[model samples]
Target: MMENRNLFLAILLSIGVLGLWEYFYGAPQREKAQQIAEQQRIERGVDQNAAQGAAPGAQVPSNPAGAPTAPAVVANPGVTREQAIAETKRIPIDTPRLKGSIDLTGGRIDDIALKDYRETVEPNSPNIVLLTPPGGPQPFYAEYGWVGAAGTTAPLPGANTVWTQEGSGALTASTPITLSWNNGQGLTFKRTISVDVNYMFTVADRVENAGSAAVTLHPYALVSRHGRPHVSGYYILHEGLLGWLGDDGLQEIKYSTIEEEKSISHRAKEGWLGITDKYWATALVPPRGEEFTGRFSAVTNQVPIYQTDYLLNAREVAPGGSTEVKGELFAGAKEVRVINEYQNNLGIPRFELMIDWGWFYFLTKPMFWLIDFFFHLVGNFGVAILIVTVLVKLVFFPLANKSYESMSKMKKIQPELTAMRDRFKDDKVAQQKAMMDLYKKEKINPAAGCLPILIQIPVFFSLYKVIFITIEMRHAPFFGWIRDLSAPDPTTIFNLFGLIPYDPASLPVIGPFLMLGVWPLIMGVTMFLQMRLNPLPPDPTQAMLFTWMPVFFTFLLASFPAGLVIYWSWNNTLSILQQAAIMKRQGVKVELWDNIRGLFRRKPRTQE
Candidate 1:
């Protein structure tokens, strides 16, 4: 009994701490993150809510530890993204998946908006602007230029160097656009920028050496974002600079990490690097089979500037000869299919890692693949989740059955257990020994019940990873009231599902727990039903944990994505049915209804 109590207490404490942490810490962190995100949105829109391309899929590798030093950021105060867009002569980017423009001032693919996704679930909501211009409040833009080598006196095309558009029509997937710049030192640099039907941009730069002497220069590409964007704050999902560098494996550096380290440099023979938000990414893919240096850095002084850049080996441009280098840029949604396509078809090294598959890549990726496959068949992500939950139950059926069978035996021997307790009422240790002997004689494993929890933990975490990390799950809707499976259920019982005028989330102290959503309540009830399949633990503390666990999870999961809560609810319902069936087949009385009714029934006053 002591050992059993210790085990139950440990389990209760572990679960209680996790639940409490989510309520006390996770919820507040998310709220703080959301507030920061909202403030960023307003600041970004403070100047029309302003606005927001690629090179060919380039191959990989890096230079020396020398990364391009970031120039001091002079933020364009009071400048709207609209004004910035209008300020420059831009080459319009009108792809089927994207619609924006390429700023000709620096010849940077600075402006872009995803035509398919929106800021909100509303169909007519503003398009999700992925990149913005330099003058914008939260400036996120990509640049391609050459770094001057030792004894190189010729000027190169840079951020301040304005390039004139060579052709007329807008930059489409089929028709590439060319921008040319003259350095006056007889160096004629031309950049041919092209885009595929999707998010990949092909930037091929050619430098003609029409001068008298040879010039040595290093070709480099970088993605820069001025201000830190709001992160979801969930540790499961990485929201910062990340990429797969050759030999270096995968480098995931958070903004805070970069700030502390100043800059992280890597020399790779083949790889790519980029800055990523939860759903969106902008990665620089250097051409294949090349030696280059990749750097993830942060410059914080007036306005924080975070940059992910790569510098390639210097190319010697002989007199009257030309040198050309082609690089690829991925600037849009990190769709699994497209990212994999680029990874496989283009020979980019482990490019799919850009999606933040986490440490459980082996399981998480396959889980996503299964969920995606089912989604394609069902046409609704929520239905797909239900189907996957059922499939998971089936896969673990034999283990679950054995566990339930063991629980059934324990439940059947409850009368003997009660008699044993009364017989050894004075000696607690002797009572535990008798109970163990009975358990051995009946061939029942009391610890078998923990199997369900063990199975649920991994499945639960993996699903949460899929829902939070993948863009496909974003904005996916279920039936009534659950519009975005990626977001928490909108309707809360605290405000009577929003019938009341004020927000319960705005209240003090208990506000976070009050966010109990409908799906969470359903999940809690299902869990309660499942727990009642076996008799309550004889110990009061153990009994208390069993009784209150459902409520604890219900409150904790209210802040989780709706899809996860839905899965838990469906899984619990299945477990209840499965356990009840196992107990009935074993000729044991299932105490579900009796235990439930006993909770509410009045007890006769005890004679003192």
Candidate 2:
């Protein structure tokens, strides 16, 4: 018993020492890594400059001798002229030109006629923004507009547009602009842009046939960041259809896209539409048409699509009939609110947050929601986690109590099990069978020890899922010096040399180190106490092997989220207390050092 207590203390001391070391080393390394990343970014910029084919320190000439001169292919150049030329063929043959411009920089939502619009983005920009008459006297292309092969005329003629303010207080003159278009042959079109809404923007369009025959109109949408048009980002084709705009990001998930034949509209059922970029997404549904039906494409290839309650096809509009298409775009950081808002909009399906396969999310949503509800009541996520943890512990209390009670009963019978082992020393099988029989006679379930640990597996996984997906914890600071709960614990210690690869500044040498420091020590102490209190295994080597569990767990969790470790350590502490209570209730004296003597300090009796 003394040895067990001493082992617990020793383990705690070791963890504290490691924590101090980690704290001192974490920050500076992180700063060093950041510096390296910045350097690489600068180098990449320089490489791009070098690839532009301009003479060293000379300005690029405005015009080439004839067509633009292709840069000579340098060794190992991955980009090719054929690739660029092939991409051009994919551009919509009937692409339209810009027709109008709006400058709301002065805190006013005033419209500049389409005639005054200028091209702000290059033709090859990932997103193609075209402006043509929504519905006007004649189709006119604005400055920097080019005609495409389809001859559909960039903007359909005779379009009427309406613009109105949205939300309160002018935050850069917010507006919801709607444009109504009519093709003389009886094709009616309406497109709306909901913009400047707290970093979110949306564009939706609808088309209806008014003539006797059905007409086919191709539907296309392009989106990009306001200023950073070239950076590859994630986007959702539909509410749940998540995908990457570029190949730069792949989270090893499944997604879907629409077929090309479905891109053309002739008016059909009224349903959902969606698309995803590298990081964000958009979802919408269009109303039925009168004569012709339209198809809504939900394009993506990274995340699964959660189908909307609305129909997927536009309704067929009859002669002198119409259709309505509605859509909402969620543009923001990859936060939970962004995802939840998108899921709630227009009855779209929610994206299931996944981790370690789907098991964690599949098991934790109910528990997480419960935690969230209580969090709302108390107004604190941390406290909510604590409450949930307590609830979980209480729920398992009966089983745990039974297990400990059985364990105590087994400890009391250890002398008999050992005696059987000695009697059957030469026959291992007989020894094991005798023990099994003894357990059966004693009404003790040998497997009881596995119950608590088995239950912990799911609980641990669920907690991990919640921590990984919940945006409520993002940047939510805790008590003193612990900022940014979403990130690793920031405890820094400077190293004279770059020996350990971790950051130190933001992680300064306190928070992370202390977290790692105290929890593992507590875990080790609890584990030692538990080992001392429980019945020992028959095999001395096996028992020693089991004793390493705390050490292994500490190492495994060294860099995990600090909050999770805190919960685990607290849980272990509670378990220890529970076990101790069980022993006291049964009037089982631990007998500390005396128990150690009876167990380990005995010499084997030899008889010849």
Best by TM-score: 1
Candidate 1 lDDT by residue in tens digits, 441-549: 8887888767877788788878888998999999999999999999888889878998988788888767767888899999999988876665555556666766788
Error of 2 at 11 (Å): 18
| TM-score between candidate 2 and the true structure | 0.56
The worst-scoring run of ten residues by lDDT in candidate 2 lies at 137-146
Model 2 misses residue 442 by how many Å?
1.2
Instruction: State the C-alpha lDDT per candidate.
Output: 0.82, 0.42
Residue 47, model 2, lDDT:
51
Once fitted onto the true fold, the runs of candidate 2 whose alpha carbons sit more than 4 angstroms away are 1-175, 178-190, 195-216, 223-324, 333-345, 350-357, 492-517, 535-540, 591-608
lDDT by residue for model 2 over 1-608, one digit each (tens)? 21233344445545654563344334434644564565456445535665786322211111111101111111112333233223221111110211223322111111222111212222332332221121111111111001112333333322112222233231222445554544467776665555432323344556666677643333322221110112111121112233221112212222222322212222233233333322333333332231212222222111111211112322444566665544433333334554555446534333322111234456676666876787789876666777788889999999988877876666667678768867998998998788888888988876676566667767876776566445455544545444544444444224322346654434555634333434445556666655555534444554555456556566546555556666676777788788778878877666444434444644311111
Estimate TM-scores for all models: 0.91, 0.56
